[model samples]
Target: QQQQQQQQQAAAGGDGGQMTEFSIALPAACAQYIVGTNMVNIPTLSKFGAALTLLRDNISGDVVFSYKGSPSAVAESRTLLMHGMNMFGVEIRRQQALLQEQLQA
Candidate 1:
């Protein structure tokens, strides 16, 4: 019965195969900052047929981001997220330099 059910699903689903899940944990503050600044581009993930889920750990003050879709889609989503984070880091450095210059002046 199990084998039969698997066969049926494969037949119904075609060559697309199964969906994959990807997840990452980030500091809560960092997650909020990026999301607030629209750095992560959530809609783009949806466009790729990937669903995004967010969970916060109150005690640890961490946030978990989960994405589910085709393996390639999830991988691409992760890559985009990392790129956004890199941009965020650059912005932070820029802000700090501006602050230092202001204090000097």
Candidate 2:
């Protein structure tokens, strides 16, 4: 039951990984809308152009996904998670910069 809960959390965070048998199977329409044809959605009432600008300035700036599990697990899965996020339309390099800042803080 505990494992299932953790799996749920991972999937909710867009982690479609097998290490924990987790994934959110987004519908085709939803997936396309999220990643758009060329970009990810900021998902606000603002216009798409404004949303793009906001994301450009800061993606997940006020938000962060912290690792709170086994260090060994993170060591093994961090690269995979990064790759998966990149594939799913996240601006990972930028986010990584933010993550580094957070870690330093």
Candidate 3:
């Protein structure tokens, strides 16, 4: 009976739960611009305006450049922090497994 109850509880719990929040921070300037203006323009560089001309030249559909730029330093920092959190989570999972093993033993 006790063994059956344990199995039932285990089945109910299943896998580890979902992550609540996910975020990536960007450059202060870019972030501010995104928040404030919400508009972007990409200029044609060549004398003939080849890029814009080509985009317009396309017969079927229009071409678009999705420009999202963030300062490298801030992006790097955020990546590092996320990596640290992932490492910490791995360590925690290992510790929990060890504890469970010891309890079962």
- Local distance difference test, each candidate: 0.64, 0.42, 0.39
Candidate 1: which pairs clash? none
Better of 1 and 2 by TM-score: 1
Candidates in order: C-alpha RMSD to true structure: 7.7, 15.6, 24.4
Give the alpha carbon lDDT tens digit for every residue of 1-105 in model 2.
978876886678634343332223333333333434333322221222433354445454332222333344544434443444456555546679899999999
| The best candidate in terms of TM-score | 1
Instruction: Give TM-scores for every candidate, taking all chains together and pairing residue i with residue i.
Output: 0.59, 0.24, 0.34
Give a tens-digit lDDT track for model 3, residues 1-105.
977765775567622221122244333332323222312131211211332344344323322222222243334434444454455567668989999999999
Steric clash pairs (candidate 3): none
Q: In angstroms, how far off is 75's CA in candidate 2?
A: 1.6
What is candidate 1's lDDT per residue for 1-105, written digit by digit as tens?
977766776678832367887777777666656565654456644442222234222233666667777566677778877876787788789999999999999
**Deviation in Å, model 3, residue 60 alpha carbon:** 60
